[model samples]
Target chain A: MKKELEKRTVTGPDGQTFEVEPLIDYYCEAHPTVQPPAYSKIIENLFNWARSESIWILGFGTGCGAIEMRPLMTPRFDAYRYGIQWRPTPRQANLLIISGYLSVKTLKRVIRSYEQMQSPKYVIGLGSCTINGGMYWDSYNTIKRLDDYLPVDLYIVGCMPRPEALLEGFNTLKRMIRAGNAEGANTYAANFDWYKTNQKRVIHDWDMPDYNW
Target chain B: MQQFEWIQIPYSLLTLFIVLNFGLLLNALMAKIAARVGRRRGIPIYQNYIDLIKNYGLRTSITHGIMFYLGPVFRLAGGVGLLLFVPTLYGSEMFSNLSFAGDLILALYFVFFGALGMALGAGESGHPHAAIGVSRGLSQMTMAELPFALAVFSVALQYDTLTISEIVKAQQGSLFHWTLFTNPLAVAAAMLSFLGSMMRPPFDVVLAPQEIPIGPPTEYHSSYLALMQTNRMIFPIAKIVIIMNLFFGGATNWPIFFAKVFLIYLFAVFVGVVFPRFRVEQSIRWFLIWAVPLGVLAIVLV
Candidate 1:
């Protein structure tokens, strides 16, 4: 555990001392719950339609696949026309594109970011590396399967998929959202312990809280 | 002036509804224009509406504190307050909104009020990016507002009244009576300051998208983000309303109002496309050196 995260006593400005546990005090410790769809089917459908049309992607690049995403914003691809926009923060983004191979080290940070995203969020495993580690399969530090650590709603398979393939993958994800098929957030909440165990198995130095959110 | 009537409540709400919708569409339209300049198709005109719905429909929202909750509220209030206080149409009571005696000063206060509220709210989020953004935003806003404040004072001196409606009334009857012709120096200064407030390139260091990851709203998401997005639509248009009334002759009806607002908004968009972004210090210096002197001269000549 980090020294700052450990339980310690500190003196305040008024000279009174109090115990502070950074993890518990600073972050919400309550586990995330599965949020059901809206009460009326019509409303849920409207929400699904809206979600499909406006996808705010978290701009975090886990691996080499991130390079491919740049072209989508360029004049040739222009994914903005398709309602796919990049958001700088995880809090604002609904789509998390794990672009390529995830090492155990990067997976820890990815888990933290994934947990921080609001419910009804999605994970897209991009490139062959996220599926079965691609060329990094024999490496000691790489994660073989992304689904083992997080709920992946879709996969765009390639060593590094072209921008065109990524655009197709986004369209497919949009269809899944509109059809009410993408429920990866709820799946992760339901199988929280199993995913955590698998995550812990590979990440030896799991110094952070069980859930960063 | 006529006595305050209860019927004006709905009348003002009607104005708000129209402005809100217009602002949303105008924003999307401006984005499309910018995209076209880059030779791309850009987002649909209805994209802002879809984005708004998706943000509001987001299932979860977390807050840092009461201030975090109030940040967007204050921002929206600021935008609404500015719009309602300013007269939208010249001589027409139905669209005049809640304009009254000394509304120019009140409008100025409302303009700054939202930023202050946002500063406090973003400060409470405990994000370093938000803090940096708030500080940069406040400093830039203060400097940018100087030229505008000077221009407002010069306009007040030139017209010999502080009421916005009176200012509009004085500018009526002929095109040459418009402040743009009567007080060109003040108009020039105010127009320059207008670029800073519009949050476009050359003056958008406060948001600093690529550098600061969206500044004050860094920690905001879901419904909270939705509220800020709503303000984002209204605030710019609200500011433009003030400019239209003050510089150009105030509009007489809905169609003219829309046209004037669109043209004024396009001025910023045109400049935004032509220029690259400035660093915070550069923008502040630009305002002080170029804009502030014109305002001072406007006041001095008046």
Candidate 2:
């Protein structure tokens, strides 16, 4: 744990020490907490029940992040060493790895795929692309924050993160899974204005036509 | 008795040998070229033949249904039918038995069987990306058909025959006899149209890796994948051969025909390097507006 802490300690924009897990904890705390779904504990327990064994992955290689998935699967890093194997179709996969930004066109496809998967499935956002659109924040397409639309269990932060970083993220997700907190509930009831402003900036500007439909 | 006496046995066998050898030779040759461009040390000249023979021995799985199984068989048959009809050289009857009496339009539609098979197989895969790619491939083909039809129509009118062999026979003289000189704009339009038809660069959006890994080849594996790969290796050579027979006289020897086709192929690669792929809508619009008009003009002029 001390070694993990040392790796995460870094200077932030304000020149203050920022520890990664603490920052994540703070962010999670800042958001409003909603009650877990009906039979929530059962879902949570079931999520934990399947975590340790046979971690089947539906790794959607959408963008540059797809290249990162190669090392994880191949001999060098060998994610299968941890019992993680890539499933061809989403229906058989336990975890959905959204490897990068969700283009509007691709997003529809992703949603359909997500729906097709069996229940007790978890989503791991691969990089900054899934978290906040990463470097493509200014692009006309791409969803800004994955959390706005789909439930993301883990946000593996990287601007094209390294293989080691991916392993670290996987470890973190494993820890979370063990805690019987697998089902990620959307805590915030409504932040319509805040989300709308971000959506406007990312998808369309004020100059674009306001279809209003 | 007289008819039996008139029949030339060795001549028929010679034609069979020529065609069987031609198909084997060209498929072997293009596999090397594609491997080289893809930056691999490479397969042996007969590697495709070995692969094809090996495919028959593999354990097969047919989950997606009948369309998937039927796709490659149809494509192979169509390719063979095309090879028979398109005249490769003067005074040859290589594909004479299968080559129905048809024109350039008939020849164009002949190869579309392969594309249709690929599209149907892709749709049956149950992968959204493959389905999307098939739709895009179909649309791109529709766009390309216009200018290509027009360009070939001009050639047909110039020579007054739809038979490719007749066209080549008519162009037996010097460079000036080629239809390429007769209408440079039509040639340019046809070549642009060919990019989409061939699914080469600037029109390779249907198979973009970043968006969709390989388009139709996405779900294919093992023997199914091998069949599709063979179709790709043969399809380009067949198309290039048609171009040669139409414009340049089909060479009686290898070097001249290969040289002309290579130059056109290089021109295609150069064009790909210069332009970026247009979106599906953009491709459709450009083909309809620019290509169709040029085609219609060529047809009118012819």
CAPRI quality level assigned to candidate 1 from its DockQ score: high
What does chain B score (TM) in every candidate?
0.99, 0.80
For model 1, residues B1-302, the per-residue Cα lDDT tens digits are 76799999999999999999999999999999999999988998999999999999988778899999999899999999999999888899788889988899999999999999999999999999999999999999999899999999999998899988899989999999999999999999999999999889988888888989999999999888889899999999899989999989888888999999999999999999999999889988999899999999999999
Flag clash pairs in model 2: none
Reference-based TM-score, model 2: 0.54
Model 2 lDDT per residue over B1-302, tens place: 01222234544445445544554566555434553554443344554444443333222223366887777666765665565556555544432223333446778888688888888887877678888888888888887877887888877777778777677777777788777776665676677687776665678878875577567656664467556656665566667778877766666665675577666766666566567787788888988888888877777776
A15-133: candidate 1 lDDT, tens digit per residue: 99999988888887677778899999999999999999999999999999999999888899999999999999988999999999998899988998998898789999999998888
Model 2 misses residue B283 by how many Å?
Answer: 1.6
Instruction: Estimate the Cα RMSD of every predicted model relative to the unseen true structure.
Output: 1.0, 17.9
> In order, what DockQ does each candidate have?
0.83, 0.02
DockQ of 2: 0.02
TM-score of chain A of each: 0.98, 0.64
Shift of residue B74 alpha carbon in model 1, Å:
0.5
